[model samples]
Target: MDLYAPFVRHVVAPLHALYEGNPIYSILRELEQTQWLSPEELRRRQWEKLERMVRHAGDRCPFYRERFAAAGLDPARFTLEDFQRLPALTKADIRKETPRLQAEGMQDVRIRQGRTGGSTSVPLEFVVDERSAQRKGACALRHNAWAGWHPGDKVAMVWGATDVDSTFKLRMRNLILDRRFALDTLRLDEAMMHDFARRMRSEQPRVVYGHSHSTYILACFMKKHGYAAPTVKTVVSTSTVLADVERAEIENMFQCKVFDRYGCEEVSLISSECDRHEGMHINLDHLFVEFLQNGRPVGPGECGEIHLTDLTNVAMPFLRYKVEDAGTPTAHVCSCGRGMPMMEKVQGRVADFIVTPDGRVIFGVSILDNFTAKFMGLERVQIIQDVIDHLIVKIVRGEGFDEKVVRGFQDRIPEFFGKEMRYDLEFVDEIPREISGKYRFTISKIPNPFQEAAGRAIGRTPPA
Candidate 1:
């Protein structure tokens, strides 16, 4: 057992929170209790927060005030229905009205500027006030607890180069308080994995945390080289989509439960899996989440684009902000008994959807997770759709790759896509990671169905 975990959780964390003048530890305590509230009660509390944030935005944020007036809508008496009718906020809007989006009377508050990783598109620069930052931090701590992690417990992190803090001050803090060591996925190779494995043997961290694909890759490398996998308490997969195959392999190698997490840079900790692992529970305390098909609300189990309203970010309000991601809402309650609602899983980024020649928009994640990863001889594969009628497949072959494997793969493509579609298979040494150090399983260049639906919803004609 981690004997020091209790001291870090109880004493050191609270002291650090006091030194920073933040209420993160206090907020975490509230979260700990609220998770067990009834679903209806949780929704009621969520609505109250939403109502307060909306009113504050209308009164103080110039962008929202003008927008509310332009739409002939009053935020003071805005109903859920009226909120749905309001135009969705886009990344373009934030870029155009950064200054005006900030709530007034924040001169005394500390603000921090941040940006998206831009793995799929251009990077988006935005700001979050100190209060919102604290709330996000607390929410993350609550999720970490679900994975049985505590601040003082040693952690092995596999993440992007930009995410790791290597400053001398942070290094000292890591040694004493945070207790984390990171492997930069940007420069990951067999050598780096070996070094990480050796460190795991020495440090013996209780938890393994990392981007989904990066963690899976590390596990594969360890298995291939006959490295003895450490017995960790739990693994947390974040940043990218965690496929079923990837999760199973990581769990098998680590000898631990994998807690899949979903979030974005703009809004931290959107949702995370509890111990039940049935589905990810949305963070209702900080966000008002909506699922839309086109511009309208979608029912449970139906695929829809996810829009988020930051109920906590009074510094820069993001109302009905379209995140360009798709997911399905669940009507079933998790056995974990958390009142927070569940989302089945993220489908994929809107841009990652492959539009077939027959006008079918299939989720890219489903293709890779359900079909591609099951192929025995294929170590990794990426699909690129530059034209409606064709696909370019990049394959990283494993030991048993042969003509039979090629024929078998060709046989399955027409089943998902129509017989009218054609594809070219390019055998590769390896699939390259994006500049953000995240891997993309599929990239479609064609205009997706969601774009057309969004254009129609906003009363604008989509590009021909």
Candidate 2:
């Protein structure tokens, strides 16, 4: 061990934490120790923290206080089951009740602004506590270590909306943090891709990370042009679903493993794949995740909507906050021997669901993934379900894609959604991204009819 570890931990790190108002290094130190505990030990510690969080929310938040009272919870004697009795926090709640949900002393908290891509037509502008960002950074550092990358390692991002301003402060920070380069993924033409490849050769970043589709496209371009660039040790795929073929192709071209990460802007670093690759481990020490189907906790291996409680983000406690994403829980321990439990996969988002006239909800993301990838000459596709009967399909035209493909879509899509469905497939040169500059493969406008009635239907006892 380095002799300065003591000086840095006891002196230098504390100064940084005080200045930044985030105990990043301190949390990182704690996280390193927590990962070694057994699964039961981890759960025991997590449960204790969760109990405190529940009581804190009930005491500090006016909205949660009212909810607690309604659930007959005596905050002093609350159990885990009593905590689950609280209602799920929905996006509408975030939009309308943020002030009510916020803690009483939030006025002095140093909060940061965050926003979603607004694919739901109601974009959310929420605030995160300053420390949540720090904790997330620490979790990321811990995960990156699994890929043989460390805190100061150079990493290039093939991502969108990167701030590349030449301001002195920004430049100094980027240099210090080792943000060597960030490829503008918005423009991936031949020249841009070639320049990106050239930059990778020059920068030799230890890790290359980006959107799953963008990474796959870059891999394809590199193979097509036969441009051999210096290798990066690992590539991280996030922000969208990573298809099986996309993961295989990216790994083959980059000659490194592609680790899939699942998260949203609302909560950061939800789950990540370790080197063993058996499944993605949940960040249990910081988050408590529940898989709910029909408003009840689904057992392991069953699919459900992801409900998360942030143990670390105390500024705005989103207890049992619905993530609007579907996921499955794993039953077994990982072969790698990590203490954290596993989440099999983030199935997809509810915004991607296709709802029908009779209240049928279809997991459109998976269905579309299955159909589109099988067909040739299909660059991209988005399913827009504005109405129950008429489905507007947008496609990026590729070679050999013409009227015959449109006829095939007319048959295949309706057969999957419902026989009564009508398809109007429109071919386009490109499908522009949302205002947030993030790509969503599917956008559904039809409201989920079962959302409101789910709680009452799912094993709820009738009142006396």
The best candidate in terms of lDDT: 1
**Every model's TM-score:** 0.94, 0.84
* lDDT tens digits by residue: candidate 2, 234-341: 988876667787788888888889988777777777888999898899999889999998778999998888899988777888889887677789887888888999
lDDT tens digits by residue: candidate 1, 126-194? 888888888888888899899898777788888877333668787777677887788888887878889
Each candidate's lDDT (Cα)? Answer: 0.81, 0.73
lDDT of 2: 0.73
Model 2 TM-score, all chains together: 0.84
Q: Model 1: runs farther than 4 Å from truth?
A: 162-165, 450-464
Clashes of each: 0, 0
Give the per-residue Cα lDDT of candidate 2 at 4. Answer: 41
Best by TM-score: 1
